[model samples]
Target: MTKLAHHLGCFLREHLPHERGASANTCDTYAYAFQLLICFAAKRMHTQPSLLEIDQVDAPLILAFLDHLENVRRCSPRTRNARLAAIKSFFRYLEYHDVSCLDQARRIQSYR
Candidate 1:
């Protein structure tokens, strides 16, 4: 289940279009968000993002990513918060749908 990219991409292509009529922009946004997530998690695990394991990403890692987005990326707080919101929502959806992300869903509550 560590293949978040393949899983998410398949899920989106198969279900999202039918369930929510997802737009191209929405798909692309989610893709980029996950890319950033993987990179951030990889940095925490001291490896290249492509070598990251999904288990390396937890609550603290997510917070660090948000911080990096705000401080290093120089993104506005509002934008950072919005991306966090989106990430939280995605995990929530994953958990609710019996996806293998329940261990990470609780981190959403820690998000501001």
Candidate 2:
């Protein structure tokens, strides 16, 4: 699997639950947010979600995904912010595992 796929699997299966002690409902919500994000990034990049790389999921793509959630999906601001929070959390988890994407993660976190 690609780095994104591997890290994502670990993040959802291991970090979010065992390390962070997140509830099942919270894990499910975060998974759903990533599902949407992966699909959005895949479609935008003209590639399968499994083929996506961590570097491809940078600040610009994340910003576009947030915009898509608001305009195209018609999600409420609350939902949008929740999705953003989930993304930020995942990126925070990713910081230690993938140092190359550290800057990207920070940009996402500082998006406001």
Candidate 3:
């Protein structure tokens, strides 16, 4: 598996559950957020989600994804913000485990 896939698996399976003690509903919501994001990124990049790299999910793509959620998907601002929060949380998780993505994580987190 790619680094993105591996880390994502670990984040959802290990970190969110055991380490962070997130509830099942929260985990489910976060998973759904990523499901949408992975599909969006894959379609935009003309690649399969499994083939996507962590670096490809930059601030620009993230901003575009948020826009897509609000406009094309017709999601409410609350839903859009929730999805963004989920993405930001994932990047925060990456901050310590993947030092190479620290800058990218910060950029995503700082987006307002």
Please give the range of 10 consecutive residues that has the lowest summed lDDT in model 1: 3-12
Per-prediction TM-score to the true structure, in the order listed: 0.75, 0.95, 0.96
RMSD score of candidate 2 (Å): 1.4
Write model 1 residue lDDT over 3-111, tens digit each, in one string.
5555556555755566667788876676677778777776667887655554466788888898899889999988787778667756766676645667677766567
Please give the TM-score that candidate 2 achieves against the real structure.
0.95
Candidate 3 stretches greater than 4 Å from native: none
Superior candidate under lDDT, 2 versus 3: 3
Residues 37-101 of candidate 3: C-alpha lDDT, one tens digit per residue: 99999999999999899999999999999999999999999999999998999999999999999
**What is the alpha-carbon lDDT of model 3 when measured against the actual structure?**
0.93
Best by lDDT: 3
lDDT of 2: 0.92
Overall lDDT per candidate, in order of appearance: 0.70, 0.92, 0.93
10 residues in a row with least lDDT, candidate 3? 1-10
Candidate 1 lDDT for residue 102: 78
Task: Give the poorly placed runs of model 1, Cα more than 4 Å off.
Answer: 1-3, 48-51, 97-100
- Predicted structure with the largest TM-score when compared to the true one: 3
